[model samples]
Target: MARRSDDAEQLLLPYPTTRRQRLEHLAHRAGGIARRVLRFVLRWLARILLPLLCAAALLQAFPYQATVQGVPFEVQGSLFTRPGLTADTTLGSWEFPDVSGVPFGVHVRPEDVDVLELTRLAGRDLPGFVEELRVDFAAEVPRIAWWLVAELVVGLAVGLAIAIALEMAVRHLRGRPRREHEVRQRLLQFGAAALVTLVVAAYGVLSYNENWVRESRLTGTLAAAQLFPGQLSSYYTEQSKAFDVLGSVVGIQAALQADIDDERTPDTAVRIMTISDMHLAATYPLVAQYAANYDVDLIVNAGDESAFGTSAEFTPEYRQAIADLAATTPMVWVAGNHDSPATVAIMRGIPGVTVLGTKTAVEDGFAVGAGVVEAFGLTIAGLPDPRVYGGPGAYGADAPDVVDPLQRAAVREALGMDDDEDGATDGGAADGENGGDGGAADGGAEGDPAGVDLFVLHEPAAADEVRELLPGQVRQTVSGHTHRQNASDELQDDDAAIELVEGTTGAGGLDNIVRGTERPPIAFSIESVSADCQFTRIVRFSIESAGPAADLGTDPATPQAYGDDVTVSTVYFRPQDVAEGRRCDTDLGVGAERPWADAG
Candidate 1:
C-alpha cells in the first residue's frame, strides 16, 4: 500500500512522464523557436530596411536628367524661387543649374529659356512647351512626395496582413490552441517588423526604376503647346488674323473701295462710313481695318457698343481697340438704349472720340442732341436715341414718351426756325436762306444757306419728324437702331427725305457662335457727299455668308443661315434727286430706280 501511494505522487509530479505531458512539452519548445525567429526578423528590419527607406526618399527629392522630345533636359528646383530650364541663348548668359540662375530678366544671371528658344533647339515648334515647363517645375516636389507617402502606407498595410496570416498558420500546424493574450502579443511584434521590411523593399524597387521617374517628369513637356502671350500686341495680331479670314470668307475684302466718278479733294468729298449696334462682337478689328483701307474721313457709330453696358463689358482691351480706330479717323458716338451712364463716361474719356450725350442740347426736347462737328466743310448734328431718356437713372423715368410736341420743338430749334409774330411757328423758308439762329453756314451752302448738312440719330422712326422740322436744306439723314438694312423702307409716304439705316455692324450680338444655313450679313456704307450736302452719293457694301448661326443645329430660329457670306456688290444712291420729284436709283441713273421701289 505504501509503494502504490508513492508511485501515484510521482506520476502527478511536473515531468513529461505521460503522453499528454509530452505533447505539451513539444508545443512549448516550438513556441520558443518561433520567438527566436521573430526576434531575428525584427533586428534585421531595424538594421537594414529602415536606413534603405530613408535613402530612397532622399533620392526621389533630387533633380535628374529627363528626355523631352528626344532631347536631353535637366529638371530641377521648386516653384517660385527657382523655376525654368537651362538652355542656350545668344541674347543672355548661362550658368549653374540653380534658383539664382532663373530668368527674371536680371543682368547678373543667365538668360531665361522660352518657347521660341526651345523650338529653335529642337528644330520644331513646341506650342505649349513654356507653359508645360512652368507647371512641371511648380508641381514636381509635391507630386513626388505624395506618391512616396502613398506607397509607404500601402506597403505597411500589406506587410502587417501577411505577417498576421503567417503567424495564424504556424499556430494551426503546431496544434496549439492560442491564448488570446499570447496571440495578440506575438502578432504585434511580428507585424511591426514585417511592415518595416516591406516599406523598405517598395521604396528601393521604385528608386531602381529611375528611368520611369524621369519619363514621368517629362510627360507634359513633349506635347503640342497651347499657351500664348496675353500682351495687347499679341491680342491684336491673333484677332486680326481671325477677322481677316472671316472677312475674306464673307466677301468684305471686295467691298472696301468705292467706284465713284467724282474727283473732289479729300476736303471737298467727305467720305463717311456708318456702323452701329456693334454689341461687343469680335468684328471691331475688321471694321477698323475697312475704315482705314477705304480712307474714311468720318466714322459714325449709333450705339450699342456693349450688350449689357456693364463696366466689365468695357475692358481695357476693348478700349484700346477703340482707341486704335479713333487714332486713324474721326469717330462720332451716339448713345443707344443699351449704353449706361458709365458707357457714356468711357466714350467721353477717349481722345479724339466725340460723345454726343444729353448735355449737347441745341433745344429743350433736343437736350441729348449734339451741337455740330464741322468736318469736310459740312455741319453734322448728332441726336442720342430717345430711349436713353427712359431707363433706370438717365431721364429719371421709365418708358417716357419722346415722339411728341417736345421733340417737335427740339427739331425746330435744331433747324434754326423761329416762332412768328402770332406765336405760330414759321415755315423756316427765310431761315433756310439767312442761316438764322445759332446754325453755322460754313458748308458749300455758305451764303445761299440752309440748316445742318447731315443729321445723325439713333432710331430710324424719328427720321420723318426731323426732316419735317428741317428747312428743306438738310440733304441726308443717317440712323441705326433698327438692326436690319431695309428699315428705311417702312417710313411714311410723306417722309421723302433720304434716310440711311446702318445695319448692325458687330453681328447684332451674334457672338462667336453663328447658327443656321442662312448667314447674317453686315453692311458697311461709304457715303461720298459734297461739302454743300448736295449731290450726295452712298455706296453700300454687304458682308454675307459669314457662318452658321448660334443655334443652327439646336434651335430653328435661323434656318437657311448663310453666316455672313453673300455676293459682294455696291449700290449707289443720290439723295438730292431722291428728295426731289425723282425716285431713288441704285445706279444713280435718271430713269432706272431701285428694284425695291419698283416692286411697290
Candidate 2:
C-alpha cells in the first residue's frame, strides 16, 4: 500500500523548470515542423514549376513575328457632334480640341489607315513573356480602364462561387471523421477550379483587345474615306503593305559629295567638299539654283557629274558645260564612272581649276590629289569616283553576289526590263548591256581594297585601301558609299568609326536607278554638319532618311501624319540640334544644301 501511494505521488508531481529550459524545447519542436513543410512544398513546386519555366523560356526564343496590319481603329469619347470645329491644327491639343457643344460628342470615327509602331516586340524582337508585359502604362487606351475594375469584380464573384463550393465539400468531409480519401478529393477539386479561373482571366484580356480596341482615329468625313481606299478590308490587307515597302527606299535627288570641315568658316580650314551622285541635269535650274542658294566657297565634284551617273545622254560638250558652271565657284573635278576622266580633265583644266582626285591638291586643309584628297584639319580620304559598287553588268542582287533585297531591286531597275528580259530568274536578272550601250562592265562594289582599310575611312574611300594609307591616324570618320540618302542621319551605321556614308544632299527619285516609272528623276541632299552648333541637319527634297525603320510612303494629307524619305523639309537633324527639332523657315542655317553648296 505504501509503494502504490508513493508511485501515485511521483506521477502527480511536476518537474521544476526555468524559462530558458521551456523555450528550448518549444524551439526544437517548431524547427522540425517548419523544415518538413518547406521541403514538401518545394518538392511539389519543383515538379510543376521547373517544366513550366523551361517551356516559357523556350517559347520566348521563338516567338511569333509579324508586321502589323493596316486596319485603322479609333476611340473618341462621345464628342463628335459638337459645334464650331473649324479645320485648324495650330491650337488643338489632344486632351481638348478647339470646339464646344455636347459634353460627350467628341468620339473619333475609325477607318482604314496605314499603321506602324503597333506590333509589340516579341519573340520577333523580344522574349514572348517579356514582350507581353505592358512596361509602358502611359499608352492611352480609349476606354476600358474603369470597366476592367468592374470586370475584375465579376471575376471575384465567380471565385466566391468556387470558394463556397469548396466550403460545402469541406463541411461534408469533416462532418463526421478525418478521411484520407476525402482530403485527396478536395485537393483535386481545388486545382480544377484554380485552372478554370486562370482560363477565364486570359479570355477576358483577349476579348478586350479583339472587341474593344482600335488602331486609328480620324474626325473628318473626307479624311476617313480618302484614307481608306479600296474598302476597309482591302486597305487593311494590301495598301498598308504597299506603304511599308515605300519606307525602305531612300529617294535621293540632290546627292552632293564634298570634303567639308565643321570649323564654322571654311578656307580657314583645309577641308575640301567633294560632290557626287547628283541627278542635277534632271531638275537643272532648281537643283543648281538650290546649290547657288547654299554657301559655295568652293565646289569640287567627282564625275558623272551629270544627271546620269552612267547615262551617256550628254556628249563631251555636256561635260564641258558641267565644268563651266562649277568654275563660277572655283570648283574642281575628278573622274567618275559617268564620263571619260581624261576628257573631263582637259575641259575642267580650261579655267586653271585643278582636276582633283587624279592628283592630290594641297588645299581645303587636306591634300586632294587625283583620286585622293589631302587636307590638314581632316584627312578626307576617298575612293576614285569611278570605284563603284558591283562592276558593269553586276549591279543587282545576283550579279556576282550582292543579295540585299533593296540592292537587288536597284540593280534590276538600273537594267531596263525590256532589255534584260532575255533571261529572268527568281534570283536576279543579268545586267545584259545595262550601261546604256557602253558594253556593261562588271566590277563588284567598291569594297575594302587590299590595304585601304584605314583607322577612319571618311567619304566612301576604298575600305581596304584606307587602312594602308592611314591606318592609325583614323580615330573616327564618315563616308558615303551606300548612296543611302541620310544613311548616317538615319543612323544606318553597319560598322564602327562613327563613320557616316557620304549621305545625300537630296533624297528623292530613283535610288540606285531602281525599278521606278521615273528615270533619273531629280532628288538632292541638303544635308549639313555643323561642329560649332554640333548639329547635322539633312534637308532632303523628295527623299529623306526618315526615322529608323520608318515608312516614307505615308501621305502628308493626314494630320499628325509622318512619311518616309519623300517629303519636303522632311528634315533629318542629328547630333543635338536635331534632337531639339530645330527648323529653318528660310536660311536653313548651315548645311550641305544651304551654306556649303550654295553658289552665293
Candidate 3:
C-alpha cells in the first residue's frame, strides 16, 4: 500500500527534477487542465440548453382552444415577438383580423373557423357584430391569461424534469455519487432549471412590454406600469375604444341618412353623391346607405377603393361588400394613385360600375371597353388618375403624352365632340377597349359642339390637361386625393371649370383603426345638376368622433349615443353667385345661408 501511494504521488507531482522530465510533465498537466475545462463547459451548456429546448418544444406543441362570438377557435401561440394575430382563410392569411395586442403571435387556422356562422353574424350589422366580438373576446380573456401562466409553469416543470433526468443519468454513468457530491449535483441541476425558467420569464416580460403594450392606445397610461394586471386592462380599454370608433361610423351613417331623407329634391334637379379614398370596404356601407336614402341619380367615386391595391385586398369580404353596394345604384369610378390595374379590373367586373381611362383586362373576368360613359341626361367624361398601376404587379403612371391623345379621342368619339367645330370630331368610335360611343352629346343632335357636363377624374392636377382638351365644355371637375372636402373655382377659367373634391369616406381604412382616437372623419359631397346640364349646387357632409360614444346604457332606442355633430354646408351656383365669385363654400356671403342651412 505504501509503495502504491508513493507511485501515485510521483505520477501526480507538479514537476520533475530533470529538465526534460519537468518540461514533459508541465505540458501534460496543461493538456489535462484544458480537457477538464472543455468537459466542464460542454456539460454546463448541455444542462442549460437541453432544458430550454425541451420546454420550448412542449409549449409550442400545445393547442389552446378559445371560443369567440359563439365560434370555436383553436389558436396556436408561438413565441415570436412580431405582435401579430394571423387568421388563416381559404383565400389567404388575414393579419390582425380583430385585434392584435399580444406580444407573441396567435394563429387561428382555417380548419378551426366556422366561416358561415362568422359571416352570418358580421353580415347582419357591422356595429352589432363588432360589439359582440369585443364582448366575447373580453369573456375569453381569462382563458388566454391562464394559458400565459401555464406556459411559464409548463416551461419551468419541463426544465426541471430535464435537469433532474440529466443529473441522474450522469450519476449512473459515472458510478455512485458521494453524499456531499450528490447534494452539490442536485443543487447544480436545480440551479440550471431555475436559471432557464428565469431567462424565459424575463424574455417574455420584456417582449410583452416592448412590442405589445407600447403599440397600444393606452401607451401613455401604462408605460410606467408592469406587464401584469395593467396589460389586461389595457387590452379591454383598446377593444372598447375600437368598438366605439366603429359605432361612431354607424352614427355618422345614420346622421347622413337623416339629412338625405329630409332633403326635398327639385323636379328638374338630378342629384349625385361624390365620395373618394375609400381605402378599404369599411365605407361601402356608408355609400350604399347614401344611395339608398337619397334618390342619387349616380355616384361618382374619385377612387382609391383598396388599401395597397394588391390582389390580397380583394378578399371575398371586400368583393361581396362592393358588390352589394353596386347593386344599390350606378357608380362611375376613376382609379386613384393607390389603385392597381387589378383594382380597376375588379371594379370593371362588377356590373353598374364604369371605370374610366382604362381598358378591362382578362383579369377583370368580363368583356372589355368601359372608359367613356354618359349618365343622368349629361355628357360625362372621366379619366383615371395618371399614377394608377398599368398592369398587374407593374406600377407607375402612364405617360401623359401617351394617354392624353387616347383619352381625348375617346371623349370626342363618345360625345361627337367637334374640337375645331369644323363638323368633325377627333376620331370615330373607339375600338373595343375605350368603350363604344355612348351616342352623341345632348346638343350634338342640333349641330352644336358636343360638350361634356362633368369631367370626373381622380386627381385635380390631372384635370388640367383633360380640361384643356374640352375647353369651355366641362361644367365641373370632381376629384378626391387630399382627404379634405373642397369645392373650388380654382380650375374655373376660360377653358377650365369649377372642381369639387371629396374627403376620404373610409376614415383611412384599417390602418387608422388602431391610431388611438385621431382617425379621420367620414365625408362626402352631394352635387346637383339641372336638366340643362348646368352645375347647380354642392352640399358637403362631414363628421368625426369627438370621443368614444357616450355610454347611454344598453338601451337600443338611444340615438344620443353619438357625441359628435355632423357638419353640413351647401354651396349653390347661380348666375348672380358666380358673377360675384361666390362659387365656393368658403366664399358664401351672409345672405347665402337663406336656402338649405336654416331649413331645420
Per-candidate TM equals 0.42, 0.33, 0.42
- Candidate achieving the largest TM-score: 1
Q: Please write out the lDDT profile of model 3 over residues 1-600, one tens digit for every residue.
A: 999999999887765769999888889989999988997886777766665565456556775776666567666666543345554433233343213323456666535554455555566476676666667767776787678567746765676667667756876888966456766877776775677566766775654522221111111112111111212234334434543333333332233223332233333356788888888734565466556655666788988887666878788877777778767666878777667678887987886676765633344222112144546444455666534443432224345565454444544443344667633333321111121122223222232233445667676555654455555444667887667776333424443357677788766665355334456767787676553444655656665633322233321111122222444544545421111111121111111101111111
Sort by TM-score, top down from the best: 1, 3, 2
| Deviation from truth (RMSD, Å), model 2 | 21.9
lDDT value for model 3: 0.53
lDDT of 2 by residue, 292-361 (tens): 5554334434334433334354565544545555555444444433334333445445562444333121
At residue 63, give the lDDT of candidate 3.
57
> Which model is ahead, 1 or 2, in terms of lDDT?
1
* lDDT at 249, model 3: 32
Show where candidate 2 strays beyond 4 Å. 1-275, 278-284, 296-302, 306-324, 328-333, 350-354, 359-379, 385-521, 529-535, 543-600
Q: Candidate 1 residues 1-600, lDDT tens each?
A: 889999988887867878988999999999999999997797555444444443343333443444433234443333223223233222211222222222211111122434333444433222243335335544554554454455444444544555555656766898979767976775676566667656654654554422211111111101000001112233324334443222221121112121122243222345778888877765656667666655677787877787655678888877887888888777878776566666777887887677753433223222544444444444456666544333433232222264444444444444345554321133322233222222234222344333445667766655556766553545566777556675322321332346777777765664223223232466657666553344344545455534433444422112123231222223333334211221111122111111111111
The best candidate in terms of lDDT = 3
Model 1: residues >4 Å from true position, as ranges?
Answer: 1-268, 357-367, 389-440, 447-449, 487-497, 510-520, 531-535, 545-564, 567-569, 575-600
How accurate locally, in lDDT, is each candidate?
A: 0.47, 0.32, 0.53
